[model samples]
Target: MEPALDDIWREVHLDGLKPVLPLFPTDALSEQSDESELLPDYAESDMNSAISALSGRHCVKLENLSISFGSVHKQPSWTMDPTALLDVLRQNPSLKTVTLRLPIPAVTVIEELGDLSRLERLEMRWWKDPGDTGTTGDGTTSMELFPSLRNIRSGKLSTFRRILSYMSTHLITWLKITVSSFSETQELFNMIQPCSALKSIHIMPIVPLAPTISDPLDLTLSFQPILKCKAMENFFIHTLNTVPPSDSDLTSLAVAWPKLSTFTWSSLSRYGPQATLEGLKTLSANCRSLRKLDIPIQVPPELPKQTPHAPFCDGVTVDIRQWRVDDAVDIDRFVGYLAPLAPRDGTPWLRLGNVKAGVWIAVGDRLRQCYD
Candidate 1:
C-alpha cells in the first residue's frame, strides 16, 4: 500500500521527527527498493526559488560556501544578476568565506560584492573574457570592482595590474600573481610596490614572448622596485625557459631587500659557479635578517682541493646548507668542508647532497645534533 502525500508531509512536519525525504515521488518506503528516483530538472527559476525559500531560514547562516558551475549546463541568464545575490548576502550577515568558480563576468559581480562587509576571506578567479574596452556598458575594469580584495590569483598581467592599482589605493595584505610572458615581469614589479601590507610574494615564470638584450646590470635595476616593498618578508621567484641573471643581479636584489628573512631562488644557470657563489655571498652579507635560504649552488667539474674559508658573521646561529652538486666526490668534499662551519649550538641544519647512485639525501642529521 502506498502512502498519501499529505500523510507523508504530516509525518515530516511532526516536531522532533526526522525523515529521509526524497526529492522524487516514491510509491514504496521499503528499504532496498529498486524504484529509480526522479529529480525535477533544475532551472534558473528553481535556483531563485530555493534562494528565496532559504532567505529567512535562520539555519542557513553559512560560515563557508563553495559553488562550482558545470561547463555543460547553459549558464542562467540571471546568474549575471550580482545585485540580487548581494542583497541576499547583506540580509545574511553571518557569511564569512565564499569561493566561486562560475562563468559570471567577474567585473560585474565584483562591484556588487563590495557590499559583503562581513566577508573575511574570498577567492575569485576571473575566467571570462574581459569585454572590449570600447563596449558602451562596461563601466570599469575588473580591478576597480575588487578594491577591497586581499588575495587574488589571475591568469593575465593586465588583470594583475588592475588589482594592484586598486590595492595601492586601498590596502591588500597578501597577493599572488602568475605571469605568462617575460615581458610582463617589469610591469609586475612596478605594480607590486603599492601593496603596503603585502607579506609574501610568489613568482612563477612564463616563457618570454621575445628575448630582450638588456645588460645583466639593467636586469638588477629592473628588480629594485620590487625589493623596495618594506612589508615583504618572504620572496620566491621561479623561471621556466628564461636564463637567470648573473650573481651580480642577485647581489643587487639582496641589497634591495635588506629586511628579507626568507628567500628562495629557482632559476637555471646562465652564469658560472664563481658568479653564483659570489651572488650567494652578497646575499648572505646583505640580508642580515635572513633565517632561511634556498638557493641552487652549482658544483664545478673540478673543485679546489682545499675548502674556501667563508667566515660566518657574528650573532648568526641557524645555518641550512643545500647543495646541488652532481658528483659524489664533490658532494663528499663539500660536506667535509661544511661540517666545520655548522654552528656549535646544534640548531636545525638541513643539507641536500648527492650520494652514491646519484641519490640526494640529508646527511646533516648527526651534524645538526652536534650543533645543538
Candidate 2:
C-alpha cells in the first residue's frame, strides 16, 4: 500500500489529485487501539497524504475544513501548522467554513486568511489552554481580516474574545460562547456592545476548575448592554448561578428589543430581580412580534383582585415560575380570574407555575394548553 501510494503521488497531473476520504475500507479496524475500539477511528497519515496529493488543486472549491492537533495518546492528533492550513486555504479559494481544534502556536498568522475572500464561518472548539494569547493585543480589533464572517462558535472564552477582538462587529450575526469562569458578566457585554449586526447570542458560563473559596461564588449577570443590539431576535443567557431581572429590567429590555421573538432569562423565578405581572404585560404590549416568553414570575396576591376578561388573541406563549405558594390565594380561582386577561394572538401564551408540584399544577397545565 505504501509503494502504491508513492506510485500514485508520482503520477499527479498538472491540476493535482482530487481529494477523497483517506481512510480506506478495512484500515479503520487496524487503526484503533483496544480501549479506543468503540470510538471513531482517525487516520492522520492518510489524511495528510491525501492533502499533500491535492496541494496543487488551487481552484478546488471546498465548503468545510476541520483540523485538529494535540498528543495522539491523550488527544486527537490532526495537528497541522497554521501555515499549512493557510496553504490549504490559499489552494482552495472557494472555502467558506473552517473548524479548528486545540491550539496552534502563533495562530495569529491566520490573519493572512484575509485572502480567502469567500470565508464566512469560523468555529474553534476544545481549547482548554488559558495561557494561549493568540492575537488579543491592545491594538484596536478590526474584523476586516474576515469581513465575510457571519457566525462564530468558540469553546474557550479567552479564544472567543481574542478572535472577536479583531472582528468588525457588523459582520457577525450569530455568536455562541462558553466561558470557563468569570468574575462578572459586565466585561462580556462591554466587549459585545459594538456588534451592531448581532442577531442571536448564546452565552454559557462554566464554573472555574480551581476556586479560591469552597463555597460557590456569587456572580452578577446583567443584560442592559444587550439593549444596544436592537437587531437581536434570540438571546439565551444560561448560568450556574441565579441572576434574575426585575420588572424595570424587563421594561428596559422591551424598549431595547421591540422585535425580540424568543428570550430566556435564567433564574428569574428562584433568584433576584423578580418581576411582577405588570412587567410581563409591558413586555407583551411592547414586543408586538413576541411569540414565546420564558421568565420567573412571583405570583402576586393582587392577581385575584383584577377583573378576568375573555380571550383576546389566538396564539401566544408565556412560561413563568410561580415563586409564591400561598394557601390564601387559591391557584384555581386565581388562574380562573386571569384566564380572560391571558389572551392569545399578539399576546404571549404564558406558562406560569412553581418548580415543584403546587396547587397551581392544574391551573398551569390548562394555561399552557389553552392556546391549542
Candidate 3:
C-alpha cells in the first residue's frame, strides 16, 4: 500500500511539471558548465559603467528635449554659453525638433541656431524692448538664425516681421501673428507681401487705424499691398476697442481678395448695423470666393427697427452672424430680419446674444461645438 501511495504521488507531480518543462532552456542541460563565476559587486559596477559609456555616445537619438527657463516670480533667462551650445547642436545632428525659452542675446541666439541642419520644427519665446539696438555685431538681425523654420507664433508683430524678412527667400506654409496693439499693421503688412507661399493668415486685433481716440477718423488706408497677395486662402481678423471700416473699405478688400475662402471678424463695433450690413453687401459683391463669414454686430439704439436682408454673394456659400450682449434685448427682434441670410441648411447663419464683458463666451462655446 505504501508503494502504491508513492506511485500515485509521483504521477501527480510529473503530470503538473510536464506542462511547464518545455518552457525551460533545453540547452542549459546539454551545455557543459564553466567553473568560473563573477562576483556580484564587480558585475554590477561593470554593468553601470558600460551603460554610462553607451549613453554618453548615443544621447543624440532622444526624440524630445526641452530647455526651460524662468522661475515662479522671475522672468526667464537663457544663461548657457551660446558657442558651446552651438557646438553641442552640431554634434547632435540627429535632433529634429527644438524648443527654446530663454533670455539670451538675440544675436548669439541666431548665430548658434543657423548651424542646425536637420531641425524641422522650432518654438522660441524671447522678449525684446522696442528701444533696444537692432543689429548684431555681424550686421545680421535675429532673423538670419532660422532659414528653414516653417511655423511661427509670436506675441509681438515686430519680432514676427523681423523673422519673416530673414526667411523671405524661403516659402512658409503657415503664419500666425498676435499683437496687443495695432500700431504696426502697416509694417506687418509690408513684410507679409514677400511671403508668396502663405496659405493661411490670422491677424488679431486688426487695427484698420491706430487706437488714438484723439483722431476718431484716423484710419490708415495702406493695406493694398497685402490685399494684392493672391495666394491668401484663409484670413481672420479680431478687433477689440477699435473702429470698423466703412462700406467702401470692405468693398475694396473684397475686390482685392478674389480667392479668399474663409473670412472672420470678431469684436467689431466701430459702426452701427446699417454700416455693418452695407459693408457686408460690399464684401459679398467683391469676394466671389468667400465660403465662411463671421461678423459681430453692435446695432445702435436709434436705428429704425427693420428686417435684415440676405447680403448678396455670387454663387458662393456664406454664413453671416450677429453677436450682441444680453442687455441688448432689442437686438433679438432684429434676428428675424437676418434669419433669411442663414444658410438654407441652417449652418451659415448664426445668432448669438448675451455676451459678457465683450467676451462672446456663449458664441465661442457654440462655435466650438459646431466644429467638434
Once fitted onto the true fold, the runs of candidate 3 whose alpha carbons sit more than 4 angstroms away are 1-66, 70-74, 77-88, 92-97, 117-121, 128-147, 204-211, 215-222, 239-241, 267-275, 281-291, 298-322, 327-329, 351-372
> Candidate 3 residues 190-266, lDDT tens each?
66665676667777642344445553322335555566566677877665544455566667767767777777655
Predicted structure 1, TM vs. truth? 0.62
The CA lDDT of each predicted structure is: 0.49, 0.57, 0.48
Better by lDDT, candidate 2 or 1: 2
Which residue ranges in model 1 land beyond 4 Å of their true spot?
Answer: 1-65, 69-96, 118-120, 132-149, 165-170, 205-221, 268-275, 300-302, 305-326, 333-341, 353-372
The per-residue C-alpha lDDT of model 2 at residue 250 equals 79
203-291 per-residue lDDT for model 2 (tens digits) = 77654334334433233244556678988888887664454666887788888888888777664223444776677677777887777
RMSD of 2: 8.7
Question: Could you give the candidate ranking by lDDT, starting with the highest?
Answer: 2, 1, 3
Q: Is candidate 1 or candidate 3 better by lDDT?
A: 1
Instruction: Please give the RMSD of candidate 1 to the true structure.
Output: 10.2
Tens digit of per-residue lDDT, candidate 1, span 16-87 = 011211232223433534222311223433443333433333323344444433332233333444444455
